[model samples]
Target chain A: MKRFLLISLIWPGYLLAQDNARQIEMTQLLLIKNHQVLSGNKQPDGLAEHSETVLRKAERYRYQGDFDKAVPLYQQAAQLNPKRQGYIGYVHLAFLHDYSRAMQYLNAYDALTPTFDDIEGNNPVSYYRGVIYLKTNEFALAIEQLNKSIGDIERKHGSEWVNYRYYVSRARAFLATSQPQKALDDLDKAVANYKKSALAYYHRGLALVQLGRTAEAKSAFQDAQFFFGAKRVEALQAGQAVIPEDQLFPLYESEIEAAIDQLKLKP
Target chain B: MKKQGWRNGKKYALPGLFLFGFWLTTTAQPLTRDQLTGQWIGVHAELNNASLCPLSTYLDLRSDGSFYLGMVDGKAPPKVMTWAMKAGQLRLDVLTYALDLISLTNDVLRIGQDSPMLFRRFQEIAVDSTAAFQTLNGRVWETDSLRLSLFANGKLLWENCQTYEQTVHCWQLARYGTAVFLVTRGNAHTCEGDYKPLWQLTQSGKQQFRAIGWNGQAVATETFRLVRPLKLSEMPPANEFQRCANCFDGSRYSVAEPFLRRYQPMLYDIRKAFEQYYKPVVASGQSGLVQIQFAVDCDGRMGRFLVKGFDNDYQAKSFDPQLVAQLLTICRQKLPAGWRRDPLTDQQQSDIDVLLNVRLSNGTITDVFL
Candidate 1:
């Protein structure tokens, strides 16, 4: 960070010495005024309209998975109006999935704002890293993180997605590393969230293989195939991506390996 | 309550996803991993404890955390409800059959109201009931290590040690419970070869041998717990003696061959090592009476062969003691798997008896004397 600060200082033809000092002073003043000066007040009508337009365009690029295109525009909107939570939230969300990266945006968010936007905005980065744990193979840890994600989410919206993601993720973890039977029990509950989930069958197949029922594994592979062709096709077309069975199972990995391989993929 | 915690988390993340909402509608594709989730195989349940122990059985736990024995005696239908692990303690229970042997009380009280003691014992009296069941009746096979107990009469010796190589004595073995114990002792006049007990521990509050000799100078003192072999299909490939992790750890492993002596005060003619590499020559042709004197060492290695009466120039005859020594060394290294090394003495000394063989052979091995 000192290196970046030094580079920012020695850089030629960049923001002038006074311009840099002026910008820092402006940021401090805005924070002190609690955004009252920035919002519900003196902004020119055209400035609000322009910021809104830029925010929408940035979000659209982000939706298309064009992070590079979205980053610069989001940065522009955030610099133009540092009070908008959505601007920082975009970067923070991207970093959240990769526990290590989430920390970076979280630090930026805390440094940039005096009052955090969401109730969870002021939370420690470990809490968000725990959210990343929800997606990892360690189900026990995932439960712990999602449990923490629960209270804040409840204070904001209701429970549902956190619970579902946690349950499903824990189910996957159990099936991947723990005993097949325990995983099966958890999947039984997870399938109820949306029903028709192939993960339950895949986990059941893994249990069967451990139980030495080869014939049952064959049936499970077939059922997994059936669900991918039907329920999962839409996800692929959307580019949100539900991993195809072939990629997850690429070779002769038994049904269990395929499931974990699929779950482990980065979004 | 539907979907619950993830819903709340997603709500916090909702503002972030607002940008991707259009993408969600655009792709219209479902995540395939989530779809195929049910198709994955279940991971095998591993117990936190026995995962490291060498025990063959597992503690089968129910959904409520009640336990049962899994994988018993290599039988499919596990001996149900035999014993259980509850609250970090072992509870043993067995079904009883009314078949009578010599009657004895099942439990012994420690003469106090609170001290209830349990005893489990089995005894077999011999009436000359013997049948050879081992594949190697007179032949010898090589192994990396061996544990043995030396006995002069019926009483066991305290000095027991296992060697990676053969020393002097060897003796025939007698089976004792799940382990094999030496039934005979060798001569003391030869090189300092004798069955020495090496490692000892207390089992059932009494001094017990960990590895003990099963033959003449044979010095094994390991506790060989009875276990059903894993299915041949599941077993790892057999490793060579040289590839063993402990082979290079200074000590050599060897095995001893114990035999019955017909004309001696001693009970066994203990051979230094097994004949895994080359066959032992008990003398072939042109002999009235052949005399062979051999010595047993503390290391269970047989050496110093003096075979008498081969009239013609001898063929290239080599005593396979080196191979036997190697085999004994291998056995010594591996035989301590279930052993409890005696804490006292820093494991420097052992009690062992070495048997020296003096043989007179005509064609077949002559009356062997120990």
Candidate 2:
């Protein structure tokens, strides 16, 4: 029993070290990869430090409500990182609220990174690409991205290591495609993963509604009120079945909020 | 001792403050509400020739933001119209009557004077109508069972027909040998339900002339002119001349037929193309009418045609709105001297409406400018 306890305690540290090393290696590869694709104002920035500074500067501009200025900085940072091009380009594409362009960036990211590789476990970038696809209502592509993110994390750690929001988002994306049956299947598994999340119930209800399961759908939407706070109105009642003009932005803000919660990241 | 003195001074100051407040209310600058309520005479309503009409009316402005136009009576109805006061100018939204009264400077109601009265058709009262108020009209009148219009203009327009790019309607004319008698229509209203033919005041003049019941022939006539069509406030004086023994009634044959048969060579070509493009609503119909609205730009060239609605007496779908749009496209593409653009005056901000009466036969359209 003592030996097992010792092993369990050591396992987390060993795994963390492995992750750190991988992060460093990936950072190096990111810095060296794809030197081409740099824009007009971004050339000859003596690599990583300059790129980091540009990213920080972009963040500052973003703080100042200068989205136009900030986006280019983030884009330059990604180009410099080379390994980050896949994720960084995707992030800029997504946050800048250009969905079609974000998809273009996501496609580039997907091609650069192999389909089988497990990079998204610690990388928030892969999850975001799935989100972009999900927002565009590209269900097949979103599922593909989410599945890869899940598969990578599972390989790195275990099935339990998969990001909770990825599963939830996958389900939501499924619903967006008008395939409530498939989405319901995802939600059933999603609730199993994180029953405490109100989103699981709320989304399950939405899926049920789409599938014509009115009673089940109604119950889920009511339960979701507990998870989503005041924002459940948009989901509980279809506020505006309006089409979204900004492609990268989530059609429903609730999904973006839920994603931020699962990622434990502040936008 | 000093504290007691300061405390006593506060009581003395109270009466002076109360007196000041009373004086403010009594001396405030304002004209009486009644003075502001009546028809403040500003602009005279006139015919299309810009000749002032003899009748006059003022607008009644209420304190509650509702508006009433001047009628002959002293009392106004509950609400005259949806009115808004913008920058001292009165804005009246009219729904059918082709009414416009622009008040000049003298007729303007001074801020402190009696409520201004707008007297329509009064030259002096309507002098400032242009300066203080602008009125738009919308009206619909009917003929016998047919809803004919008095001033050749349609009763209602969706977009500000005045403001939109191209809005078209139909107008017909008559041909007497080489003499082209440009046709004008009087009110759809009649003593007994009958149509009347009111022709233009010669080729140059804006006023219309009425024809004493004529030898109503079945000659084809189509002429559509793009000049600003006039909206008549009253019908022309009815002539007593009548023929007892004739199939052509003064109302129908002398008026409606000649107006409908008025032909345009180019518009007819477009209509013919429409018939060829779409199966005619009336099979074996050799001739069809394409009722279209187009813009006449500053140059004499015709602008595009946007059709609001369409009706075909024969089952002929030749004059479809889509086909009209295409015909208008061709007109813009081909006609150089067709559109006209006037110098930038405060008045002429957009192209004028041109209602073309077009005929279709063997894939060709003849358009008459009215």
- Write candidate 2's Cα lDDT for B1-370 as tens digits: 8889988888777997888888986663333333345444222221211222111123456667676543222212223556544443444443211111122333343221111122321221112222111111222322122222323343221112233321122223433223222222111221111112222112221222222111112111212222233355433332211211111111111111121112121233444344454433332433444545554432333535444321223232544444566556545554433222211111221224345445454334422322
Please give the interface root mean square deviation for model 2, in Å: 38.9
Q: B-chain TM-score, every candidate? A: 0.18, 0.25
Task: Report the number of the highest-TM-score candidate.
Answer: 2
Tens digit per residue, CA lDDT, model 2, A165-259: 66778887777778788788777777777765565776787787677666666567656655544433343355322222222322233443443
Listed per candidate, the RMSD to the true structure in angstroms reads: 38.2, 29.0
State the lDDT of candidate 1 residue by residue for A44-101, as single tens digits.
Answer: 4775566666766675544332344555676666666654543355343432122233
Candidate 1, residues B1-370, lDDT tens digits: the string is 7679889888879777876897787753422212211111101111111111011222332433233433212222343344333342223332211111111232110110111111112122221112311211222222234422222222221222344432223234443323232222222222111222212111111122233222222223344332222222432222211111100111110111111111111112122222222233444442222223332232333344344332212222233344334333533432222111211111211212122222222333322222
Error (Å) of candidate 1 at residue A4 is 43
Error of 1 at A234 (Å): 8.4
DockQ of predicted candidate 2: 0.01
Which residue runs of candidate 1 sit more than 4 Å off their true CA positions? A1-99, A103-131, A134-141, A149-163, A175-182, A203-220, A232-267, B1-370
